[model samples]
Target chain A: MSSTDMLQVISKNGKAKRGAEPNLPKKTLLAMYEAMMQTRLLDERMINLQRQGRIGFYVPSTGEEAAQVGSCMALDDTDWLFPSYRVPGLFLMRGVDIQHLVANCFGNEADLCKGRQMPVHYAFAEHKLVSISSPIGTHIIHATGLAMAQKLKKDKGISAVYFGDGGTSSNDFHSGLNFAGVAKAPVLFICTNNQWAISVPIEKQTASETIAIKGEAYGMPGVRVDGNDVLAVYDACKKAADRARKGDGPTLIELMTYRRGPHSSSDDPTRYRGNQADEWLDRDPILRFRKYLEVADMWSEKQETELIERLKAGINAEVKKGEAAGQPSLETMFTDVYANVPPHLREQYENLVRDEGTGHEPDPDAAFPL
Target chain B: MSSITMVQAVNDALREEMRGDDDVVVLGEDVGINGGVFRCTADLIDEFGEERVIDTPLSESGIIGAAVGMALYGLKPVPEIQFSDFIWPAFDQITSEMAKMRYRSGGQFTCPMVVRTPYGGGIRGGHYHSQSPEAYFTHTPGLVVVIPSDPYDAKGLLKAAIRCEDPVIFLEPKRIYRAPKMDVPDDDDYVVEIGKAAVRREGTDFTITAYGAMVAVALEACEKAAEQGWSGEVVDLRTLLPLDEDAIIQSVTKTGRLVTLQEATKFCGFSSEISAIVAEKAIDVLEAPVKRVSGFDVPFPYTLEHVYMPHADRVLKAIEGVMTY
Candidate 1:
């Protein structure tokens, strides 16, 4: 494939183009569409929840569901996933307990993070999904390492990490991709080039022809896909996953997608991006995939309605369950620092309790002398 | 027990751990074939083979970030930073990613890895090679900072760090890696518990607290003080974080005067933290103000490397100043 050529398995009209069909099972394709819809509704609910002050923060996967869900569907349950702030679709596709994901947004006592991290920093150990840290491109190297460890153990598992176009500018991106290439680690680095990192456009992020082409510099195969086309994204990921399992080394897949909503609930896209985003609205992966499924005679209007109602009810119930979990206790702040709390920390905790009784702020200068 | 240097002790500890557990792997620049620049990982590649002993590209961030990933995947990766000064590139991986993995995952995932690096100044490595960056690691919660002064402690603590369930920053004192050989146990099961300070010498005149290379320097300073008819107690803090406050408080209570020594710069250094803790718990028992003998508050210089580090004279001066006060 040429460097600038985009690999697409589906066209804008929701029809399989020549040499593009992923040939996934009809059941699997239907499930992928359901996950995309579920993710869309979850993003909408989360954005609404944040606006209503029910949740603290949110980063909606809005227009990029196909890129997130389709690629995730291509991987097996054993393959590890290291997702970025976006891509809740990937988590949903992996069967991550929605309750846990929602509870994390609430940062409640039941939350896996123990209220230590921001919302969307979801981590489910059983799912083989590593915890999400706020730093962009950091997980790329971590995924590479996980792949290396798997390779050392002679395991057939591969690691898939997802990041945004903004992550490409991070030094860790270079470090991770270079190391992965040199080590021939079984890792798939998927960059959802959503065209913006906060307000910074892709044009200003790098002057390179394409993010996928940069993989060549790091000694890895690079491929660009029509990220909005779920089939295309799924095909690219499946191929990369196969290559990784066969010890063909890492591959960088730049999913050509777009962010339909503001960067996060905290951001205002109108300030940076004009009405240009309206053009991407028609390219909605959910709508496009729904049309494709209808042409395949595997979907109906009733099915779409049922899925929407089911997801709305499920997400709403989960939000209520999440909100009801309540805030973590004050003592939780001191816990999880270490497996065993050391003597000094225990004493410090007692001191805090003692100081709390007096209802006064700690005066370290008064407590200790020069 | 076998006589060995800190470097040899470290190599033995890594070999022992790698042999004891199949999950234990060592990775870093020049760690495989070259056996590391300081020879701390010498012969490890041949013994453990290339799979377990990985020679990574010269990228500090990559080394640490990948180690965190490896640790998450249930491997005990002991990654080396070559020198403590080079750890800056991996600071984000250590502080933001590795350290927070366990806490952020609510104990579901843990980075049971050891980051080994040579630290401190004495053999004229200048600024780039010589540095005591323990305070930075100590400042980060969810991280265990260990610095061993001698071969015995180096071997024992290293073995313990490798088995630790959380991330550990093992700062090997480069200056004393070869000097002052000591008896280290050859047993594979030998391990010194972290977060416990060792009292090297017992005295009542004053207490001297130090770690890593400063432990030997403090002992030498105590010897010089003894010639002046003063007896001083010495404490070697094997671990910086989860600091053995009980040991520190106990020593200060007995001596009624404290002198904390460190090779890091004076500003916000480990010595200051120790001094603060001493003042917090044992102020009533103190006869004189706690003194801190530490490096100057400036970047380590090439020409004045010795002067920039806390030597016996500086430590003795603090001891004498505390006594006179």
Candidate 2:
């Protein structure tokens, strides 16, 4: 197959070069760029939030803007998105309000998760985004199952699932891929092989040269790309999403990206990683795209200044809006425990009401034991 | 109004439910072509076709574990374990993973799967085939445990289980699979509510609560007690977990004494929970302490089969002891 068939555009610089690109207008591209910049600023600010002990840990999709925003931008609004911990870029590009992210990170009252879940375990059922669990590979299986259901429902849109190199080690990963392949389910598994899983290197995660190669065993096409390059990620994801809609089954795309920050806002990356960090920084997708736009005279230093000011102001407003929502009601605890809470739990909640106002925190250490 | 054996009732229930819902699928070891070791799933493959009736390999974890995954996707999976004693291999997948997924996802997810297995001792099947394992699941929170004693309840409760939106462990007393039969509701739209007990006999002297095969023994003991001039109210606890505490309290209220029986090890059995609840809820109504008449705390006996199962005589003795106290 010709290489151009797999990609719509290729450039080290983010310019309006007219070399076989999509019909996407210049205005749409600029909007996408603004979204990516917003996500980066948000990531940096959230890390500061963590440092100030305002929010808990966060996993930034920082150096991989092209991969995150590009693939997400390619899909329709109705298409299902199953994201791993990172990918705030995709979340922002998909139009999840910045205030919601702030409420989520701060785990406040306005948070859709009811403050019960950890930060980053985002769930917006209306957006077709299934809730994320702390367990790594469980959602891979769930995504496959959801895709199969969509097949039964004859849904026009395809399911897009995100995972990491470390997630591929789970047994469900193999089972999920195998089932989707055999059933010819419309789904795309985008593996953001960011090279590190909390200190475990990609070399240790798999002996295969690329994360996409594992797809061969499941009888699906596996493709490797420059994850930092937004154009490549967009083009590859677009092709796969089209094939999926055509009932061609699933494809695994390995986007070789990097984690510029700590695994979360926690940890010190300088302790273990090598000069590879400096190398990844050089290939930084956002900067490379900015350079390409500069070469085309499509972007300027003034645009960067305006973009930062707009994003910072927008984010600060959202942060204030999120904080003003106040903490989720202590009463939010009783809700979402079940579709219909049993009498036992209701009695416990009533006891709490009778005692003070809301139920005291149940003994989590005794119940969860983990 | 026809009489059927326990296994036949299960077969009838599966056939009826399949005819009712296209999404219900039956998959397990030897459950399709081979008709299951106990013949509980006989003729399902021909009736429902391969897509609905699956004969899986001997992988307990894979069978129950994958059913959990399948059920989460909207298909109703009824997975059968060959024997109650062998369910532990899939217990972690069932109890920890499947049972808790809905709650852990904080109600965002639900797995509606049922694991049907033949349980309890009576025939000379020894420890592996015998053994009552419902106690382990009764302790689990999200799972609904159902053990049917006769054909009537089996057909009704199982249909309820297959449709219910929770992981249910449906234990069919293997020894009584062909032992007895009774009239059941017709037209196949029967659904006995889960977590409710059926009263076999109503009497005011003492209460006898049991389930699975032991309910028959308890009834027989109550019959034998009529000669000795003692009254007994027998409650067949159809659902063990989310147990019918209401029926138990009501029965104990009149009898003023309770004797719980099971074909399981006496230690940490379902009877233990019944005793605790009776003490907690019905302390005022009790004229005597609630006693549990269970099998010895040993691996089910292989050589001494009759001694292994709870007998009518033991039930009678326990009833007499509780009433006199």
Candidate DockQ values, in order, are 0.79, 0.29
Candidate 1: residue pairs that collide: none
TM-score of 1: 0.97
lDDT for A123 in candidate 1 is 89
* Candidate 2 local Cα displacement, residue B107, angstroms: 5.1
Give a tens-digit lDDT track for model 2, residues B1-325: 6778878889988999989987788888899898999898899999887657776556566567557655765788898999988887677667766776665554666778889998888878888888888888887778888998888889989999998878899999887888667787666888788878999999989999999888889999999998899999999999987778889989998889999999899888889989998898889999988888999988888899787678999888888898677
| TM-score of chain A, every prediction, order shown | 0.94, 0.91
Candidate 2 chain B — worst ten consecutive residues by lDDT sum?
A: B100-109
- Pairs of residues at least 3 apart in sequence or in different chains that clash in candidate 2: A13-A292, A14-A292, A14-A293, A15-A292, A15-A293, A109-A327, A109-A328
Tens-digit lDDT track of model 2 for A191-300: 88888888888899888766777888788888887787777788788889999998889998888788777777666788888555887777778887777667756788
Q: After superposition, how far is residue A240 of candidate 1 from its true place, in Å?
A: 0.7
In order, the TM-score of chain B in each prediction is: 0.98, 0.97
State how far residue A201 of model 2 sits from its true place (Å).
Answer: 2.6
